[model samples]
Target: MSIKNITVLGSGIMGHGIAQVSAMAGYKVVLRDIEQKFLDKAMEKVKWSLQKFAEKNKISKEEVDIFYNNITPLVDLQTAIGSADLIIEAVPEDFDLKKKVYQELNSLAEKNIIFASNTSTLPITELSKLTDRPDKFIGVHFFNPPQLMKLVEVIPGIGTDSKVTEEVTNYINKINKRPVICKKDVSGFIVNRVFIPMVHEALYSMERDNVSMEVIDSAVKYKLEFPMGIFELADYTGLDVVYKASYEMNLRDKAVLLLHPRIKQLYDSHDLGQKTGKGFYEYKGDNYERIDLTPEKASKYDPYSIIGVATNNASWLIDNEVCTIEDLNIALKLGMGLKMDIFDFFKKNGPDNIMNKLLELESKYGSFYHPNQYLYSIK
Candidate 1:
């Protein structure tokens, strides 16, 4: 639990944020990237963040100086990570790139040093195969904007040592973040596996003429009562990101790929929701208002009731021991920003009713509506 030095590989958004938080926590943080320009840009971002904190009165100017002083940008892996007690790999999600990082880390780290990946999708068990100490390796999935977010999904692969897991969890808590331990490594871990599918279905709903952005969004606002509608979130998270992930999910699992021609067309055209300034609606400005005259129809009769049913099914994941009641709640709140505990949501509306509704959606939406097998047995 005592980390004197930490190394953050990659100078991308996640890496810089990781370094920022680590430096703030008083650890000597070294952020590594290939080129000097990348490190320069990352250093600028880190300074900008600390300055923003100072401007907002979150931290004093002197404190910002202290934090920035603790952070160093490094070009050489050996110099950056040689003495690191902990390493957080935040490189690209590409497998080969990550494995290369792993090889370099394996050569540098001592037998006791822990290695963790900041990946959202790649399997931890697979990553463990590359490292000599799978027992010392774990998945530490931090949500974006690490300083603001509170939750970290701490996933341990099949061979990951329990002691290593506990130590890493303690370190995560030390950084003032909540750690949700995933007992087994599953694709997308726990939150994204369930949540991403929901996003995928929403895209399918949009394409199937099942609903309009305005209607789906309104029904979601009025019904399930998410902080923001799914479409709005899609815009924020970038439609292209979810689309590609879903397509991979479909490719991996023969179940419910949503191969509907209309959906495919959207993917092919690269109409990513908010980031590219297009998706269900052409997004514009900070609030992401729609610029198009697309039909704002409800895809189904009483879609809110139906979405409630789906979330109800999601609750059963707890009953089946897929994750604890607290883990599920934290996932929604931290990973997706739901307002309240999901256990409360499930207790309010039981699971069997949800199962029946999932069936209803299944019949209407084809593969998009297949009931999650995890939900059926939660009774």
Candidate 2:
């Protein structure tokens, strides 16, 4: 089915951006929230963002006005989604809350309307079970600030219909976003599955070796050419978010993964990175210079070893049939904000070299670094 009317539930950070992008893409969008005040604030943010886009010449002023006209903000969920062709939920990452929303939507929504969640880590299959239309339920996970991020992970639940996947993929493309299909409903999905563990390992390395955060961050930034170091990205993403993701993943593999003590300490203290103004580094209104971090102390840590764990997990995704190697590379490059394709890096460094690095890391960090069969097959 062709989607023209899109309803975005929850007018929070992810919700407002999704609504704005949908409207900008020429779709009629309904942004629903529990309170009028929240909706009003969200609308204001959207307006400011659109104006900035217009000023930057990314969009015309006339187009911004037209986009604003396409969006309808409301407090009534049923009314907002009454005629919606597709509804994307961007609520908090609580499974119980999400299940409740899906149950309510199941009772009130039209039979043919597609149901999707923007959940970062929850299992799609479990969420799909809460809905009446399991075949139409899927995960359309978008990166933060959907207006800027280009990658969206389209995941299919165990019972999702093939046609529904195609329809959702088409609609995402219509919004000028790239879609990386995750064939399985695994924990952390594609990008997070590979990315988060690497961040965790980096934290583990720093704490274990008593290394400076700046050294590790600078090494990953300059040597690997990543947009930011893992810790820096963690701060930007919120340390709590990174911790929760790691905690959740560990539950899935009880014997293997563990949240490093430093991350737990930071999360417990509520110094959750950019949002809280303190994390691995301090942020003073977009300037980190106040922290007095010296990035010149190059790390003793091996860059390939850290990246190998990530590519090792990427290989596992291929082994488990989550996504294609090409799609995994695309998702990693875009979703993780890397400047280069990981596979290309692997080619330049050689598969044997990567395998040796994984072996070395596994010897030190345990089975989480153990190379998947796909890596073995590479040579």
Identify the runs in model 2 with alpha carbons over 4 angstroms from their true place. Answer: 255-257, 286-296, 347-354, 360-365
Q: How far is 98's C-alpha from truth in model 2 (Å)?
A: 0.8
Kindly provide the TM-score of model 1 when superposed on the true structure, using C-alpha atoms. Answer: 0.87
For candidate 1, write residues 169-232 as lDDT tens digits.
8888888888998776755566666666666556555555555667766555544556677667
lDDT of 1 at 215: 74
Local distance difference test, candidate 1: 0.73
TM per candidate:
0.87, 0.93
- lDDT per residue as tens, model 2, 205-246: 776667777777777776667778888888888888788777
- Record all residue pairs in model 2 with backbone atoms less than 3 Å apart, i.e. clashing: none
